[model samples]
Target: MSRNKGGRPPKNEGQKIKQAHLRLTEDQHKKLMQLEDQIGLNRTDLFIKRVLENQDFIITKDVLIQLAKVGAEMGKVGSNINQLAKHANTIIKNHQLPPEIVAQYNDLLGLHLVQERELYKVLRQMYRVMKN
Candidate 1:
């Protein structure tokens, strides 16, 4: 025979355990594994955390890939601009460059600087999104 206890034992002890069964396709499983690795959580824990926190865990692989490609392209553009600037400097140092040509180079450099600033802003926004 057992004695009667209070209304509730404690927070965790008073709660009844519940089980949920999930079925995932092969691709879904693989994606979940990838997400687990990226988020540094196991499959069950990650799912539980997301559900309990009421958080949306939607992975936008396409957008991430596109952003990476754009970043690479921007890097290439920056590299090319750097090489062009070095060549121009060398030429200017070795031989006399016309004032008009120097002025044109300066304008091109300014344009590249503006482009770099814009790209940096976009990358920062993307980083913020990824961080959150």
Candidate 2:
């Protein structure tokens, strides 16, 4: 802790200062100004308060427990997918394959790729929202 001129510990003594300029759309600017008028706080103070609120702080030990639970569910889904691919390979091996089956598999893989790309787009949008 850093001491002030009177030798008392200073609040937020070691905190880093932020110096980034943010751009807002005209509509967003108008809305934020309206909020500022109603709340009696300037844009800077309101923005800082919102940024602080958006920070993810650990509330309890159970937070990690919840994350682990979700991770396990994802693992199960991955394992199931792997098992499905293995079963499909086995079927391909056991059959005198027609071209249609191969085409269907290729189409399914393409669909998965498209879905993955869309998912990434959505996730990027969510991250942008969080940052803003």
**Candidate closest to the true structure, highest TM-score:** 1
Q: What lDDT tens digits, residue by residue, belong to model 1 across residues 49-111?
A: 588655564345666687789878978977987897788789889997788877897898789
Clashing pairs in 2: none
lDDT of 1 at 43: 67
lDDT of each: 0.75, 0.65
Task: Return the TM-score for candidate 2, rounded to 2 decimals.
Answer: 0.40
Instruction: Look at candidate 1 and give me any clashing residue pairs.
Output: none
Q: For candidate 2, lDDT tens digit of each residue in 1-132?
A: 995577656669557566668799999889978777665657665666567656332122354466468557756756776886788788888986677877896787678668657856755664554465
